[model samples]
Target: MEQVKVFTIDELMVATKNFKEERIIGRGGYGTVYKGLLPNDQIVAVKRSKFMDEGQIEQFINELILLARTKHPNVVRLLGCCLEVEVPLLVYEFISNGTLHDHIHNIDGASWYSWSNCLQIAMDLANALTYIHSIPIIHRDIKSSNILLDDSHTPKISDFGASRLIPLNHTHLSTVVQGTLGYLDPEYFFSSQLTEKSDVYSFGVVLAELLTRTRPLLPVRQTDQNCNLAAYFIQSIQEDNLFDILDSQLIVEATQEQLIFIANLVQRCLSVKGDDRPTMMEVAIDLGELCKQPTNLSPIEREM
Candidate 1:
């Protein structure tokens, strides 16, 4: 792959039309993402990070270097970057379908995405995580919002701002805890030891979101504060009420056996102990097999 080239601040500003509000595609704690069209007519998604200190700037550079080195079908492709700007800008391939979050939640009034589609999307994400973990990179954040889908409905894992590059020889690395609360690994929260398993845990939450069709966090009642869906899921599983919490649409189409299998996989992933969680490779293999089975095939045929 060709090395990612850096763009001048003026070039980026021009491409994004001075970061016009109309071009804004996404926003987060770190920055606003805008859609840009280069002079060559190449479309891109540009991330303009918020104000930062020297340490944060260095970290952003490190993230760019890591993104440049990564090239996988399931991983978001980085076109280049602009570091000379007041806030570092990251350019990535424009994913037209937006985020997995939007599809699952239908926040924009779109029809609910199919359960099978959700499963396929999760499989693609798992494959990406497997690739990232192969190089021993731990993506501390692995939620629906971080997954961008292309026009073809293929999912690509994005947002590596919170990722940690673990040395091949090391089992774990110590760092100040950072990650979305609901999706964080319980072990990492307590020990402050970051590992690939942390990513596994977060992926589990994503899997749950796919199955349940609910946000990671949401308000429980008008009178009560919001609750964490992950915690709610764990409790439901333990209480033998998984079906009650599962998405109604998914349940209508899924067989009892298929539901049980997926629930079991989620259970294994959300294991309180990080060591008990399956590796991304194992999860990918299981999900790939699930995806290949004929959806409308009879249970007898599936068994055969």
Candidate 2:
């Protein structure tokens, strides 16, 4: 692997053209991401975090160490970093295809992404999560927005701000629960005990997102009540009415067998009990195999 060099604050400023609003590609609770052109003419994504407390600074260091040690096609590559500035900045290879959430939920934008493309993205994300779990790191935050896409529409896992490195001997670590609400593992949320399974659970939610093509949480009916898609999906599965909840587009294109396979996988991942969920490795392997099989033409039988 090539060594990543630290950039000076001045250099980064110049590359980003003084952080122009036009160059800003994304923003989140932690920071903003800007598209930058380096002196070498290489395009990169620059993540600039807001103010960091002592503990956050330590977590930033941990993220750096983790990214530096890990390299995989499905995982975002760290090009360099700029820590000399007031707020720390992380440079990564630019992914042109944008976030999975945009393609799935944003109706005003392009909508040509086929069901096959969605499947590939999900498989790629699974591969990345499997790699992270192999190294014993729990992402704690796995969502459509966190999975970036390259020019070819290949998915790469990004955003390590909420990640935790677990020791080999430890089954679970007690820490302040931190993650997006809808995708968070319920077990971890209640107990504050995190494990790799937490990431698996979140990834399961991502899979559900792909299948349903809906936001994690959405308003139901005329009331102020909100419905979590994950919880709703699990309930639908139990009632044998999963088709009623699946994305209409996906249902039109996907075969019954294929949909069942994917639904079963999602159901297992969303198991309220972490012990019942499959490992990331197992999930990845199963999805990979599914990718290789040709889609069958059998029609889905509507559940009575």
Candidate 3:
């Protein structure tokens, strides 16, 4: 509800208690997030990057510009940014809850990971993607960890550091490959041609996670090997073992019709050719329709 245009580093220092370790809320490759209290008692999440090299300053500025222009309920709101210091800082509205990753993995702060909740989260993220893509922007990185949750479990898509704005004249952009390993689009990985479909491909991995409630990467044998959940999912589906990969909790709660519908949708999103994938807007609409369908499963039934 509170909006901060820009705050001085001194003010942020006061708010975050001089960046005390106790105020640190989250940590990632980009930087750390701190839970801060502003002058008017406004609660916010402060993102401070460790370093911005010669090549990354533009990406940082691009992130700030994109965040500044974003306006959506599902996308995290960027209140302001501080550029006075060597390490730029971004202030965002605090999401009281946690990331979708926590909920899906039953990590600390996990509330309820019911089928309905997962569906709603997917719908929310899809809607956020739709809005951003309509602005002709590619999130570049889309994953459960990037999706934050509020007190009521509403999702807010965050982290625009890897985003790129596509010109109207172009359908895709040629750029360096950047994204998480598990969710990386195969076509983009090979071609270095970034497009909106790349996001769709990553989102398919999210949908797969929702179905299976497993990390995108999985530990294998004692040899330190790992399994890629995306390939695992496609293999399972193709072998007619889709149900085998489903989250145990969802099996009893989800309907056969709905699961098949969503699984089919995921297949399209994960299509080998980006040209065959659905647009974010189309995916958003389909997910919205999926979640809105009436169900016989009760709340207690879903929780089990």
Candidate 4:
């Protein structure tokens, strides 16, 4: 655990070109992230928080404290911070290859969308979750867009504005439910009791997105009336229509065993009850085993 560096506002201003609009890379509930070039020629992501109220300040400091001590290969690294002004700014390592959402949905993009890549990314994220949970911290937000990619297309989990650190004796926390619409854990939403399993549920949704290359919140379609992806996915699996909703590329390229294995894993993860879901370590181990399986034969070819 290295100490987080304190950066000056002047340095940040110079790095981000005075916070120019064009430098903006991402915007979320907490703040906007800008692509900055440090004086040392290091490229970084500068997160400028949106509000300075008590609640907002709590999240900011929570993220700062949590990320300062947290260091994992799969999780985004918090390099420094600028607290000279009221609204604090955070600096993180810049991930060059954009997000998992971009690669999954951008069908025409140069990035590869192969099953192996998806599996690798999932494993990376699962490993990250396991590490974070071991520290008794809940990410609270684990979606495709929050997952950044390095130049090698490795997944790096980011965006900890909604994270929480659980006390040593507590198995769960009672807090106002906050998460993305499509990926939110239904149990947490209704009960307001957040557990690590909430993150598992969101990770399940991300896996579904990888297989389907569809948005978590599906648009209205002629045959499918359900707009929520988790419900749609579970329904499809139960109806034995999983293949119907899966990406055509995956159907052609992935083995039947591999697809079935991951589908079952995702289903278990998306269970309505948090207690029914597997731990992050379990998910990571399962994925590690799946990654070892050979991908030489496709489902279509094997059937033929």
Candidate 5:
């Protein structure tokens, strides 16, 4: 594992052109992220903390320590940090292709990953979650926006601000539940007891997004009733309308066996009880296998 370096804020400022508006790539609850070039000519994403509160500061150090200690092809690599500034900053490998959310939401975007690409990305993401789980860490937030895609559509899990490091002997932890609204695990939401299974629930939602290309929650303008995608998805699955909920492109491009296999897998991930949900390792293996099935065949050819 690479030890995180300490970079001067001045160097960061120079690389990001004094943090110009155009350099800003993303904004989140944690802070604003700016795209920059390192003194060594390496492109990086600089996450500047907006909140000076103790909690926010802890998340910064927590992510730094966790990311420095862990290394995986599917997880974003933390290059360094700058603590001299009023707000601390963390530098990560810059992924130019943007986030899974961007591709999923912006259907017309040039960076959109195809059905096959989405499957491959999910496998990589599962591998990342499994790696972290082996280390006994829980990524409290596991949403599309937190997942960055590389140029080849390879997904790298990012944003560990809400991550928790679990002790070796502990089964779960009690904390004030903090996660995105729609992707939040109902079990964790009710009990405030978090475990790796919470991440599974969130991953399930991600799979649903990939399958349906729909937001977890409906847009405010769409209806007075907020749409719960998972609930609707599960209902559709029970009613044998799984294929109906699928994106039109996927419906035609993906084989029936392939879609059914993934629907079953996602269903397992979204199990109501945490204990009932498959572990990240199991989920990843299943997705890996699912991705291997041929997708270019016609519907009749697939059945034959």
Candidate 6:
């Protein structure tokens, strides 16, 4: 196993050219990410944290330790970190294609976003979740923006600043709520008790987003009044208009049977009660079986 290197602040400074604005690749509530090139010509993303407050420091340490132990193909690799700085910085393997959110929202990318590709991405994510959850880690925040894609469009789960590791003695951890708005688990939000199912609920939102290619908290269509994708998706399924809310591309390319199967799975995942949701392992198995089914699309459509 490769050890997580403790990088020097000076080395990171040179890699990012003294944190030049031109090197910036991403920005979030936690901090900014810069494209960095190490001395050995290895490309990486350097995350410069924003603060060193008690909570921030705790989160920083939590992420560092958890990521250091995690190993999964669909999980972003933490190459190294710099703790010599005031706020500290995390170094991650650079993923060239950007985030899943960027691709889904981009007209050019979404135009060719095939259902088969979407399903495979979902499977990759589910498997990643299964691995982390088995390690007893709750990703607390699992959303499209936190999911990065490589050149091959493979999804890798990222941003574990809000994740938690559950102890073997405890069934759940009672902690302050933390996660993306639309993807947050209602049961955990209300009770302040975090569990693995919280990730399942969040993953449900991501799967819903993938199938519809719509923002989790925004109206997909002007005629739609609902802003919450979870509620809107459940309502659509309950009202027997599931196909109407799905992406036009999905409806034409995916078999009706598979669409319904996945939609039902999504509904179960979004259940209000955590116990009602399926485990990540179960979800991965279901998706794997679905992917094995023959494609309904023609060769041209499959290539889309």
Candidate 6, position 41, lDDT: 99
- List of clashing residue pairs for candidate 3: none
Query: Per-residue lDDT tens digits of candidate 2, residues 274-300?
Result: 999999889989898888877644455
Per-residue accuracy of model 4 over 1-304 as CA lDDT, tens digit each: 7578999999999999999999999998899999999878999999998787887778788899889879999999999998998878899999998888988888688358788888888898999999999998999999999999988999999989899999989999999999999999999999999999999999999999988888999888754577888889899999999999898777776788899899999999999999999999999999999999988575576798
Q: Residue-pair clashes per candidate, as listed?
A: 0, 0, 0, 0, 0, 0
Off by over 4 Å in 5: 110-112, 219-226, 298-304
lDDT of 3 by residue, 1-304 (tens): 2354878999999999999999999987688899999989999999988776754566667778888878999999998888898767889999988888887888554447778888888888888899999888899999999988898899999899999989879999999999998999999999999999999999999889878988888768332333878877777788898898897667777787788888889999999999999998899888888887765577787699
- lDDT (C-alpha) at residue 102 in model 6: 96
- Any idea what lDDT model 2 has? 0.84
Give the true-structure RMSD of model 6. 2.4
**Residue 62 displacement in candidate 5 (angstroms):** 1.2
TM, every model? 0.91, 0.92, 0.92, 0.95, 0.93, 0.95
Task: Report residue 292 deviation for candidate 5 (angstroms).
Answer: 2.7
The alpha-carbon lDDT assigned to residue 147 of candidate 2 equals 86
- lDDT values, one for every candidate: 0.83, 0.84, 0.86, 0.91, 0.88, 0.91
TM-score of 5: 0.93
- CA error at residue 116 for candidate 3, angstroms: 1.4
How much is 227 displaced in model 4, in angstroms?
1.8
* Global fold similarity of model 2 (TM-score): 0.92
Clashes, model 1:
0
True lDDT of residue 60, candidate 3: 61
Error at 5, model 2, angstroms:
1.1
